[model samples]
Target: MIHLERVNGDTIWDILKLTVADHQKNFVAGNDVSIIEAYIAITSNGYAFPFGIFEDDTPVGFVMIGYDKDEYWKDAPAIADGNYNLWRLMIDKAHQNKGYGRQAVELALRFIRSKHHFPLTM
Candidate 1:
């Protein structure tokens, strides 16, 4: 079964060993520290989140969610209020077609709802 879990600095660091070194579109390329830094930034702000999508406890993708357009912008009338936005989501190419992506996304949504501490769901 696939699962979604919150990412800490340690887990993010560990995943670097597997997230590939050539992905640059959304991930930091060439170095793992870039990933660590990105997650750290997210956690530090209290307004963003990142989740590790795991299949049978093994990581397969990264899903980033965050509260939108804060003070910098009017926080546009999102998909809905009290709902965060998915900033970037990527499944490791190796794991893309094995039905894990669907499971991973479902897992991510669950994690996000839990993180928000909301009893209501989508």
Candidate 2:
């Protein structure tokens, strides 16, 4: 099973470690304390909402979905006009294609819907 929940101050560490570790392995851009710190900084703000994706009890990946651009990293894309950005739609290598990414995306969408953030699905 897959699920997504908000990454508040309490849940940031696990997601940070998992995400940075994956980035260290898969991303040519590299991952480090500084990068993870940057993610933490954004999550501390109101403009971004980060979610942890889990398979059963273990974290599989994380996604930060929101509209603000100033909080993103230099490499991250700016959200389109009137559209929210779905950043870091990642599933761990061990869990990829088990449909977890879709589930996580759906959960994020549903949660967004509850907030009345998006009037139309894109």
Candidates' lDDT values, in order?
Answer: 0.59, 0.61
True-vs-predicted CA distance for residue 77, candidate 2, Å: 7.5
In Å, residue 75's CA in model 1 sits off its true spot by 10
Indicate which candidate wins on lDDT.
Answer: 2
Candidate 1 has what TM-score?
A: 0.60
The residue-by-residue lDDT of candidate 2 on 40-122, one tens digit each, is 64575524566778777788877767554444445644344445666556665666767887888888887666665533233
> What lDDT tens digits, residue by residue, belong to model 1 across residues 1-122?
77766667657754554553355445533224435535554455435556677777678777666654444334456563566676556666667678866776676676666765633232
Clashes of each: 0, 0
Question: What ranges in model 1 sit over 4 Å off?
Answer: 20-46, 71-82, 114-122
lDDT of 2 at 9: 74
TM-score of every candidate:
0.60, 0.62
